[model samples]
Target: MRLIACIIAVCFANLLYAQTAKEIVQKADEKMRGKTMQAEMIIKTIRLTWSREMQCKTWMKGNNLAMIFIVAPAKDKGIAFLKRKKEVWNWMPALERTIKLPPSMMSQSWMGTDFTNDDLVKESSVVEDYNHTIAGDTIIQNRECYIIQMIPKPEAAVVWSKVIVCIDKKDFLELHSRFYDEDGKLINTMNSYDIKMMHDRIIPTRFEMIPADKKGQKTEMIYKNIQYNKPIDDGFFSTEKIKTLN
Candidate 1:
């Protein structure tokens, strides 16, 4: 009977810790993405030999909708991408057609950058699709953080086999995350830096995604301007609406 009691206590403690870890992740996600947001950003894809830059305006509503319109780079102007719920579409002005992105394409690099399409559009929910557990603690950039480990649920369609993230304790910022593949090989690392006050929230203004095996190649995304909790209509993220932007 003593052994049975100990087993039950351990199970209960694990369940409680899981809930706490999930809540931490949810809070950090909410801090980054408010109810609605409009922002302008610049992305630089750097390689040892060459580098490319692109500028765009972005709108995001909750976790279900997001749209980006490329406004710079004369040759790539008028290109846009929209994500509505589980579907993603890309609009090309030169081709004059909208391409629906399939699940297989989500893992591909976005606009030749280190970030994947899923990273930009957020097709899968980090909170909903993964089981969270408190891994440990660490300090990043002088800020104390809670290290959380996330494993994909059996039914989830996420790409990473395992994700370990460090969340700032005070502000709930995601300071860093390491992504592993199915074979438990480290695939990429994302580091968030340049913390500042954007509108009413304190967050990271610059994010860098670096490939694990690649050398001298990384993508940097920096926010130029952002407004949180703005009012944006749902119609703005539709396929028909994206085409009209061109």
Candidate 2:
């Protein structure tokens, strides 16, 4: 009877662990939904070996839509990018024009940053677009992580064929991701670093993207003074604001 009781307890413990991991991921996703952020970032291009610092703002509604507005360095001021559904558009200050980004260019580098254009914008939820499986448990930067593999669902429109993510075991915050192309070739790796206190929660302050083929080609995004869940007008995301914002 004692042996049977021990076995039952072990099974219960395993179930609890699985539930905890799922809750962690759900919390992280919930915190990011319907939020706006303002930041100053330094972008470095490994290919050109050049870097630039700029101020920016972003608004996101759920995982499907977001917009980033650039506000600094004079030359880049008033420029913005909008992502809605599967479409992306860029607003240029000099030309006072909006240009729609072609699907083929989604993988191109974003403004000389190490991040691809797709990386700048968030995509559909990993749970919605892919089938997630817990790969294992590991440690990343001293924090226990649940290593999860996400493969695109059969009907999902995803650029990468597969993605591996490490989520913090305690907070469910995403720590790292490895992206693979359709040919099963590893294309890029992204790391989240420098956790900071934002809105009473510890959040990653810097996100770095590095290409697998280009040595020393990397982009690092540093977010400062982030405030979440701020009140923002829908008009802020409209084309009118894109035209007049500076």
Candidate 3:
């Protein structure tokens, strides 16, 4: 009789603590990205054959505008990309040309990295494009998390068929995420680590992504500097600016 009573008590507690998957996702997104943000990071692409580290600065405003410019790797410097609404443009300083990226190039890898151009440009908003369901709970890095399975809504413009996200329960940090293909096969997995206070928010300072089928390939992004909700001119996210400014 005591065992039965204890089981019921535990179930009741879990029910009270559980959150809707959509709510959990929104909270996690809000924690990471606020209105306008500017950040500098280094991306290390580790391959069995070769490894390289690239540095860049990025600026983003909501879901509409984003711009990134490479600052390091002397040979690849002055390369920039700008995205606004559904449009994307790439500036090549070596060629002195600004080419508009077509929709067909969305799936191409960015800078020869595991992340695709669409992933780098972020043409879609995660919160708006997907229908989220509370799958269950799991533990990541010794922290309890809310596991959410997200599927694209009808006619939503998204590439991934499904994405599973694990968000830390206490601070709403996204600890890990898995991307699946249209056939429901896992394609890539990304993990967050080294949680620390940056600016005003506590977030993971390091992110690593690996392809499921590739054993010797991975990409790691380390946040060197970040400032959220900083004043940024809308005019700055333009092809003209990308062509001229570094």
Q: Best by TM-score, which number? A: 1
Candidates' C-alpha lDDT: 0.94, 0.75, 0.88
Q: Between candidates 1 and 2, which one is better according to TM-score?
A: 1
Model 3 clashing residue pairs (backbone): none
**lDDT per residue as tens, model 3, 134-191:** 7888999999998888899988778799999999999999999999989999998999
Q: State residue 125's C-alpha deviation in candidate 2, in Å.
A: 3.4
| Residue 24 of model 2, lDDT score | 56
* TM-score of model 1 (CA atoms): 0.98
Question: For model 1, what is the C-alpha lDDT against the true structure?
Answer: 0.94
Models ranked on lDDT: 1, 3, 2
Q: State model 2's lDDT.
A: 0.75
For candidate 3, the 10 contiguous residues with the lowest summed lDDT are 13-22
Order of models, best TM-score first: 1, 3, 2
Residue ranges of candidate 3 with Cα displaced over 4 Å: 1-19
Tens-digit lDDT track for model 1 on 1-246? 999999999999999999999999999999999999899999999999999999998899999999999988999888999998889999998999999999889888999999999999888899999999999999999999999999999998888899999999999999999999899999899999999999999999999999999999999999999999989988878988887774
Q: Give the clashing pairs for model 2.
A: none
Candidate achieving the largest lDDT = 1
